[model samples]
Target chain A: MVAINKEIVTLDPHLIGVDWGSTCLRVFLIGSYGEVLATRTSAQGSSSMNGSAWAYEQSLEQLAGDWLQEYPDIKVLACGMVGSKHGWLEVPYVACPSDVNAIAARVMSVKGVDQRRFDIVPGMAYRPANGVPDVMRGEETQIAGVLSLRPEASQRSCIILPGTHSKWVQIEQGKVTAFATHMTGELFAILRQHSVLGRLMPSQQNELDPIAFLRGVEDARQGMYLGFAHQLFAVRTLGLMEMMPPSSLADYLSGLLIGHEIQAGLGWRLAAGLEQAPLILVGDPSLCAHYAQALSHCGVLNASILSNTAPVGLWAIERATAGVHATKLAHKVNV
Target chain B: MVAINKEIVTLDPHLIGVDWGSTCLRVFLIGSYGEVLATRTSAQGSSSMNGSAWAYEQSLEQLAGDWLQEYPDIKVLACGMVGSKHGWLEVPYVACPSDVNAIAARVMSVKGVDQRRFDIVPGMAYRPANGVPDVMRGEETQIAGVLSLRPEASQRSCIILPGTHSKWVQIEQGKVTAFATHMTGELFAILRQHSVLGRLMPSQQNELDPIAFLRGVEDARQGMYLGFAHQLFAVRTLGLMEMMPPSSLADYLSGLLIGHEIQAGLGWRLAAGLEQAPLILVGDPSLCAHYAQALSHCGVLNASILSNTAPVGLWAIERATAGVHATKLAHKVNV
Candidate 1:
C-alpha cells in the first residue's frame, strides 16, 4: 500500500515530476533546487491503467497521495507515454525544432479527483523533408534535462537516449532541429526472446564477453553493405559452428544490434554535417557505456552519458512556462 | 489416415522424395519421368520430432505408409532440417562450391525400420573469404532442382529462395559457389506478432496493399543510408500519424523487410561481380512473386519465379548419386 524505498521526505516539496512510461510509474518529489528529495515508483505504468479517467487519477494518487496531501498546491508535471493516445491523456505533439519554451507552452493541464491539477508534457514530432516522420514522447523531457545541465550543449549537440526506441537527437540554439529513432533495443529483445537466434543462446544469461561483443560491433561496421537481416544471421552460424559459446551469443547479438544502430546513427549525424557536434548519451549508465564502446569502435569518442535527467527536465519546463506567464501578465498590465 | 487430396497413385514409384523442414514434412512420389504422381504432407517438421531414429521413420510412415508398403525397394531421399543437428541425424554440411555429386557424396545414410535404407542429402555451408559463414539445408536441393530444369542456369545464376530465412545463392557450373541468408520472413513474423510495431496493426491481418507495399520498398531503397531499424520505425509513425490505415501497415512492413533483402542481395551480387547472372526465384509462388515485385522495383527486371523445386531437386540429387555409382562400378570392372 505504501511506496517502496520511500526516501527522505521533503517537508516543502516545490514540484512533483512523474516519469510515467509504458511499464513503470516513477514519481520524484523535487526540492526548490530541483533535487529529488524523495522518489516513489510502482509497476502501474500508463499502459497498465484502464483507459477510464478515474483509473489514471487513482493510480497517481496511490503512488504520491501523502505528498499531495502535505503540499496541496505543489506544481505537478508528468511526461512520457502517459500523454500518448493510449495513455491517461492524449497530449498533441509539439513540432520540432522545439525548445523548453515551445514544449512548456503546450502542456495539457487536467483536473484530477477532488480538483487536483496536473500538467502533462507534450511530445515532439519531426517531419523530415524527404522521409517518414519520427516522434518521441518522454525523451523530449530528457533532452530538456540535458540542456538544463549543459546549456553549452544547446548551441549545437547530438544526444542519444538508448532504450526501446533509441533516439539520436540534434539540438541547435536550445531547439531540437531533427532526430531519428532506431528500434534497436526493442528489436534485440524480440529477437532474443522469440526468434531462432534465441534458441542458440543460453536461457540463463551469462556475463558479457568483450571479445565477442567487440567482434559483433566490428562485424556490424564492416557488414553495413549487406544490411541488417543478413548480418543478423551470423548469430546463428556463429553458435551453430561453435565459434562462440552459448553464453557469449546474447552479448554478441546485443553488440551487433547496437552496432548497427550506431552505424546508422553516425551516418545520420555525418550526412547533416553535425559530425563535429558534441555527442552525449542520456539514459541508463550501463546501456550508455555499451553505446559508447560501440561508438568508439566506429571512431566516435566524444559521447558522454548522463542519467536521471527527467526531473531536472521537468523543472526546466516548469520555469519556462512560468517565465512565459510572467511576460504575459506584464504585457496585460501595460495594456 | 490417407494422404489429403490423394492424387493419381504412382503405379511404379521411382523415388520417394521428402522435404522435411523446421515445421513441415512433405513427401513426393516421383514417377519415372520425374513428375510428382502423389504427394503427402504433415505438420511434423524435423523440429517437432523426438530426435530419435524411430520418430523420423514413424513420421514419414504416417504420411506415406501406403507408398512405402507397396514399393519396398524404392529409393528414399530426404532433405532439409531432417539432417540438422536436432533432426533424425546430424548430417555434416558439404562445403561450397558443391555440386550434386559433392552433396550426394556426403549424404548421410541411416537404416530405417525393417532395414530400409534412407539417404538424407547434406546441406551446404559457404565460408565466405571474408566475414561470417552461411548455411542452408533444404534449399540446396531446390537449387539442384533448378539446375535439373534449366541446365544453362548452372553456368552462372543467382537463385533466391524466399521464406523464413530467405537465401540468395550463387551457382556456377552446376555448383553452389556462394550465398547469403536474410532473416526477412522470420523478422517480419516476430516484429508483427511481438514488437511495438505490431501494436499499431490490426490483430486480424488485412489483404496486402500494393500501393503501401511499393511505398515501403521505395522508402527502403532511398532510405538504405539510415539502415533497416530506422526505416522500420516508419511503420509505427505512419500508423500513429494516421498517414496509413492499420490494414495497410502490415503490407508496408512486409515490403520494407523484403526491400532491404533485395537491396542487400543486389549489393552482395554486385560485390561478387555476378550482377549480370540469371536471377531466378524458387519457393512458394505467392512469396516468390512478392520478392520478384520488390526486385523489379529495385531495377532488377530479369528475375524469374520457379515453384516446387524441392521434389525435382531431390530427384536431381538421386540421379547424380546413381550416375556416380555407375561410374565407380565401370571403373572397378576396367581395373
Candidate 2:
C-alpha cells in the first residue's frame, strides 16, 4: 500500500470523480469540502478505448497523470459507461427501485498501478410496466446527485437526460422507481445524415431557427392524421415547394423528433394521471434547452435545468461507501 | 419525322412502353392488341442518369436497341420518375381528382436522334384533408393500369404502391381522388444501415422469418403505452436479452415499420368511414406479399396484387392518346 500524506490530504484533492461515457471522458478533482478544484475533459470515450487491453486504467492515467502524481493519496470515483460491459469493468446493474445506498453498496473497485484505488458506480436496470427491460449506465448517478443537491427532488420528480439515447426517469422518495429510454437523438442524427431528408438540409449550420422548430413542435402536438413517418416526408415536400428554407430544414427536423419523443414519453405519463411536477433536466445545456422548449410547448411549464451532476453523483457514492466502512470499523471496536 | 412502316406498325409492334424509376429502366414492346411481344430491362434509372446530357434518349436506346431497329415505326410511351424535375424532362403534375384521359391529355413529347418520338406521361399530385401536398410519379400509371385491368375498380378502390416512398392512393369513378406518401421503406433502410438498431441485426439473411415478423406486427397492432419511438428501443433490449435472435431482427424490424405505416395510412381511411374495398397493391411481388401480410394482420383481408402494372399502365395511356388523336383528326375532316 502507498503511504498516505495526511498533511496535504486536506489542501489537495480528497477525491477524483469521473463521468465517462461512450464518446467523452470528464474528470473532476474535488476538495474535502466537495468543491471542485480542477477539471479535465477528453474525447477518449468508451468506444475509442474499447480495443485497448487495459483501456480504463490507461485512459485514466493519460488524462489525470499529473494530478495523480501531485496528489497520490486522493481516492478515485467513477460512474457511467466506465463500468459497462465494454468499459473498464463489467459491473452488473442494480435492479430498480434502487436508491443511493443500494447503488453505493454495489460499488466495485479496481487496483491500478502503485495500488491506486478506483471505485466504479454500477448502472441501473429497470423492467417497466410494459415488461420490456431497459438499462441506463451514467444517468443513475445523475439522479442520485440531483437528489442529494435538491432536497425537494427526493419527494418526487421526473428527470430527463437528453442526449444520443435520452433517458426519462422517475424518482420517488430518493429512489429511482422507473425509467424508459428513447433513441430520439440517434434517430434524428441518422435520418438527417443518411436518409433522403438530408438532401434538403444545408450541410453546415450552428444555430437553430426558433420559428421552424416551434412549427414542427406544433405539428407534432396536433396529433392529426399524419404520424412521425408521414410528417417527415412533409419536411421534404415543404422544402421543395419553397415554403421552408433548406437552412431551416435541420431545425424543423430536430423539432419533429424531439416533439414526438416528448409526446410519447411524457404524454403517456400525463394520460396515466401523473400530477404535474417540475422536471429535472440534465446533460449538455444546449440539448437540455431544446427538451425544455418542447416540454413547454406541451404545456409542461415547470422544468429546472441541472448542469454537471456527474461529479456530485460520484462524490455522494464515495461518501456513502466511506461512511459505511467507517461504521463497520466502529462496530468492530465496540465488540 | 421518321417514315412509319405500315406493315411493321400493324404486325410487329405499335408501341414501346417504358417504366423509368429512380433505380431501374423497364421497357415492354407492345403489339397492336396491347400484348407484350418482347421486353428488356436495365439499371439505367433516373438517379444513375442524372449527370448525362441526354439520359432519357440514351437509356431508352440502350435498353431497346434491337427492338427499335426491328420496329422503327413504334411510338414510345414512358412514365414514372422520368418526368420528375430531376428526370429527363419535367412534366407538370396533373392535380387529382384526375381521370386517365386527363393524364393522357397532358402527355409531353420529346424528339430524340433520327426524329424518334418519345411521349412522357405526367405524374399525379394531391392535397389531402391535412392540406399537405403529396405527389406520385410511377404509381399513378399503375393506378390507371389497375383500373383498366380490373374494370370493377373504376367505382372506388384503395391502391397501395409499396417501395422507397410508398404511395397510398384513393380512386373514385376511375379518377385518383386523394393520396398520401409514407417514408416507411426509407426509414427502415436508414435505421437498419446507419442507426444503433442496426447493431442488433444480423448482416445477411436470405429469407424473412414469418414468426418473427408476425410478432412485430402483433406488437404494432396492440398499440400499447409504448409508441413507435419507445418500441424501437425494445428491438435492441430484446436482442440483448437473447429473446430475439439477431438473424430474425431484420424481418421483425420490417414488420414494425410496415405495421405502423399500415396503422397510420389505412387505419386513417378506416376511421374515415370508408367501406372496405379490396386494396389494389401494385409493386414488386415479394414486397407486396409482406404488405399483404401486414394488411391481413390489420383485418383488411381483401388485397389484390397487380404485378407488372407499369407496362400495362403505359399501354393504356398510349391507347387513350391514340384514340384522342384519331378523334381530333376526324373532327377536322368533318369541318
Q: List native contact recovery per candidate, as a fraction of 1.
A: 0.84, 0.54
- Clashing residue pairs in candidate 2 are none
Candidate 1 — which residues are off by over 4 angstroms?
A1-6, A324-335, B1-6, B324-335
Q: Encode model 2's per-residue lDDT on B248-325: one tens digit a residue.
A: 888888888788788778765775445466578888889999999988887888888877677667877887887642
Q: What TM-score against the true fold does each predicted structure earn?
A: 0.95, 0.90
Chain B global fold similarity (TM-score) for predicted model 2 against the true chain B: 0.90
Best by TM-score: 1
- Candidate 2 similarity to native, TM-score: 0.90
Error of 2 at A65 (Å): 1.5
How displaced is residue A155 in candidate 1, in Å? 0.6
lDDT tens digits by residue: candidate 1, B186-246:
9999999999999999899777899999998999889988978888999999999999999
